[model samples]
Target: MTARNQGGCDGEHVCRIVDRAGEHFPGSRGKGLTARTQEVLDDLGVVDEVLHFGFRHLPHRRYLDGDQVAEADPHAQRTPTPDRPYDGGLLIPQWRIERILRTRLAEHGVRVELAAGLAEFSQSANGVHAVLDTGERVAARYMVGCDGGRSTVRKALGVRFEGETKEQAMLLGDVELSGLEPDAWYQWTVRGRGFLALCPFRHERSWQLQAVPFSDLGAEGSFPEPSLPYFRRIVDDLAGGNGIRLSKASWLSTYRVNVRMADRFRVGRVLLAGDAAHVHPPAGGLGMNTGIQDAYNLGWKLAMVCSGARQSLLDSYQEERLPVAAWTLGVSAEGLPRVAERFVNGGSTDIADGAPSDGQQLELGYPASSLSVGGDAESGPRAGDRAPDAPCVDSSGTLRRLFDAFRGPHFTLLGFGESCAGPLRDVGTAQRGLVKPVWVGAPGSGADLVDVEGHARTAYGVTGDTLVLVRPDGYLALRAPGASRTAVRDYLDRVGVSRSA
Candidate 1:
């Protein structure tokens, strides 16, 4: 549901989301939201609602040469951790997520103007000037292009989209059909023809179809048009027409494998995000997830800058995310071949079959960024690592998790011992609601947060009087070994986190 829309503004319709499509329709076949992505939704306060509409994982039932059903679980071996609550991905339709996000936005008086598109935009010292497809004008402080691949914003920035388009092409659509059981995802791969997969939508009554026809529609090697009639013929040809009827297409799209990324993510006041920043093979279900990550990382930084933080904070967006985009390109490049091989050898369930262990993305860290600072500590999470979670008790003997402390739009100053109390109070007072300091120790030892089962200490690898400063996005910005307030304060000052040392 990530669009080629304009985002980032407020009040008097100053910032608007301009979508080129006239209506809200599910557009892509990507529906996997990984564990790391769930963390982002948790911070935004919508993970429970999303979970209500999604399933743990769907089994892939493959049909080889029109017979013999083979069933496999893509996420069978994964398990949840004290630190990583979500193990794999949740399978829900794209439209459901879009609706949830839109509803959340509307609660804050944010309006999404449908049937409107970003015709063009220009950046000036004062701000940004934009013209919509409806011939309306908009003025804003900054602009972010959350648009998809083939984005108008990326093109306008003259950012070189460096990569190659694959020789293989595909037909993807959502439709109404009968004679197919919705119990498991159905896949078919004949001798030389490519594979076909039908995944039932968890929320909707329809199913998503992705396949390669290889039938002659015209020219030398051109693919067939994504029409209901053509899909019917192909399905019939492959299944021998076992009374499986196809009709009324709700959505249809042609997918050409494109692995590309922008040379740079920003230019002046205008910046690029999501598919506008990177596009990859649908393998690993990384296209939509990567775009969502882009938005999550940019959202807070943009908010801070708008509230008058230093401009350099926005520059870190490019520094930290560009490397991740490069990593995504590599994973997708290797994954497509595994999926392609499945058509011949029956190795995969869907396009997402080839993703490696790290696809959960829970371990993704920004160790090299300028924002990550301090310590030559031998063990524990280093600066820029994702903050781990552990179950614990509050001073009132109430059960809580480390995530409960880090949930909102504020920093968490976790002191491993009572000796760090002075720095904690000072930081809490200085940053006000921006920083919350929580002490971890035994009850009545003057520790507000008790490590009930020693899970917090073990998870953090804490063996001493240490202090870790977690960013609003849940990554550690500073991890000082000696509970030094000076260390914490100096690091915050450098990152433009308000409050001088």
Candidate 2:
């Protein structure tokens, strides 16, 4: 989804996206939305719309051989805090998520060209020439492949797709069915009957069905088309029908446990992102979220390069994101078998038994990247960690979040003492659109932002004045002593943020 259509880049750089698919398919995939994704949506200004339609907590109501057996949650739910307004994975169908994001992109004048996928592309020192599947040759400054695990761009680049696909597979679909409670996730694990679960979608009569039959269903890339009759038969055999009737289906697809990643994220001027770069097992819902993060991480950097930043800044995309993808592959791989074992042989509700509690990837960062530097505190977030959000008070007695200060397509510099005001102001004035500076001090100490409750200090682990520079994507790029505006200016120079040119 990263800048794949006309004017797709985050800012004004002309961008375009081509979806291989003919249209948006209504599929209920990726049941959990982590807080990190929420933060990205927040940064994009679509978090409120996503929250309006998504849910956080729902108990999985389990059954055995046509009898209601138990009810338990899939994972632990956390309450929203000031520092982490989005607490846990949200339950929004992948289709709705796409629509929300698509709408937001459209708001920015992005034009998504559907059914026009990349057939082949060639790049030179300056730009790329892309031949779409539609036989249209388009020229662009750069090219990014966000297609999927079976990415044409990846294949064209001859990049090796590394990893294995498990024999385990599942049937996924959204069907309009009646005769069951629409609120709970109904699961049936019948001996020899196979495992089946029906989860209701929000504000829609259709429920998403996840089923695993005992038979292998002719594995190895061969499977029957997802049909309503096949689903009804499964419901009859495995679920004992339960009087639930499927009127029709909106979307249907089969999922295999594939854990794979590209050997390289970029080749020449053509770049790979999302599933094109990596694909994960269904175990932790890491597939979609990891891809989204890849796009988010690349978006700002790509925009910068497009806007004349150092070309080396583009190198950091893979340098930083490839490791995250590798880590995600490992995590998803470790959790998949446990999840499959439980789904096939039901026991506990924590199907993701060994998955990281940081499911939302809030703790995710690029600590080792060239972009991260200068945080020496042992207890607080170091460079490359997400800049913690804190609620601070303004002079008007208004409450403002650190996120509020961090929003928009700009670097943010926060100085936590009075002494930093002068230099911070100077930088803000010089790099007005690139970096926004906010000074925090006691109410009467005359700072741009006032921290009366010490929330900022608590969240950031600051005992005294400190200077923190956050990148456009909200990761702490640099954290140093408050007086070292020189370090700030140096980093700006390194990243090539032109001073209001």
Model 1 Cα lDDT, one tens digit per residue, 260-344: 9999998888888888889888777777778888877777787766655677898999999999999998998888877787665
Tens digit of lDDT per residue, candidate 2, span 352-469?
Answer: 4546666679988989988998856755788899988888888787988889898888899989887687769878878877889999887788777888887887788777778889
TM-score on alpha carbons, each prediction: 0.92, 0.94
Mark the regions of model 1 whose C-alpha exceeds 4 Å error after superposition: 1-15, 216-221, 241-243, 345-350, 444-446
Candidate achieving the largest TM-score: 2
Best by lDDT: 2
